[model samples]
Target: GLNTADLPAKVLANRALLCSELGLADQRIAAAHQVHGARLRCWELDEHPPRFGSGAERSRIEEADGHLTHAGGLGLLVLVADCFPVALSGGGQVAMLHCGWRGVAAGILERAAQEFDASPVAFVGPGIGRCCFEVGDEVRARFGDVPEAASGRMLDLRAVIEARLLAVGVRAFEHLDLCTSCRSDLFFSHRRDGGVTGRQAAVAWLD
Candidate 1:
């Protein structure tokens, strides 16, 4: 997951690059947004997904926390600085999830894995590793088992998430050990920024 939170416009501007990577230069390509909760949505060219906003009539990209696609050339986008940008694809379907502790506890991965047509392959993008993701006992308990990370506390989200995936029978997955909190210069961190930080965009598409 790339952190382009502060640069949604830039990420949007890079549509051509996205197209090239997804082999979608000829078709209209779009991205779905990310929210904190566990609501899932699938995207199509006819109906665009909503983005983050406040309004009565919203698009799926605006409201959905994560998205999957069977449409060719279109991309499922997830923006993250420290949160997990989970990308999974199988059975001609690809899905990207913006997972925080809330999402993990909400069982987003399990839902996604079950929703996927075939076995899903996941990529846990750069985020705050257990070394940086410290939490209190209450929050740690929510995620179930707090692993000691950082100066104090035990709640390594990535490790916990990996275990969750395995528990759900999602055997294909990998985590990029880079920690956003540890490397603030390279990646954005909501924690490092005290809540205000830019975002990186993680995207995937079908060929």
Candidate 2:
């Protein structure tokens, strides 16, 4: 489900619903102010969980594009419209990443992979696929001549993510393969919606 807009009250209400469905307490959900960069922050098991209500919102990380956690009952969420959400889990830890073209080029996956002692299993969630993600010369130059990263004038963002995961020794991985732009009924696409869109969340936590 997409949490519509940046309205705090509405977004919180939607988050509360997701928390209820996931069997988690509202205060235990930890999110970040995503900047579409490769910066990752670790959620320690011993630290206090962030509060969600008014006056306590400062507990959330101010600037980060990814989160890694070895703790249970603390949900790590990455909100996305057209960007890929990559979830990793193994060896008692889990991580969630917000991967757009910039984040991928900045090595967000490789940075997150180093946090796990072993090669973790990955799940690549929905985003804009190559069929609809058209890019100009500047964006294309950042990805080189990788076939999956370029299909004529289009760019496959997930393909770059997959290659990064493989390079980081993550062999066990799954792609949701649903393009957000292509499937408006199922996802929120910023591109398709002309920059006014809700955000879908990819959440992970240790059980």
TM-score of each: 0.79, 0.92
Model 2 per-residue lDDT at 27 = 73
**Tens digits of per-residue lDDT for model 2 on 46-134?**
87556643335654546889998888988888889999999999999999999999998888999999999999999999999988999
Report lDDT (Cα) of residue 18, candidate 1: 53
Any runs in candidate 2 off by more than 4 Å, and if so which? 1-7, 53-60
Error of 1 at 184 (Å): 2.1
> Local error of candidate 2 at 33, Å?
0.3
lDDT of candidate 1 at residue 66, scale 0 to 100: 76
Weakest ten-residue segment in model 2 by summed lDDT: 52-61
- In order, how many clashes per candidate? 19, 0
Over 4 Å off in model 1, which ranges? 1-33, 45-61, 145-152
lDDT score for residue 73 of model 1: 60
Cα error, residue 129 of model 1, in Å, equals: 0.9
TM-score of decoy 1: 0.79
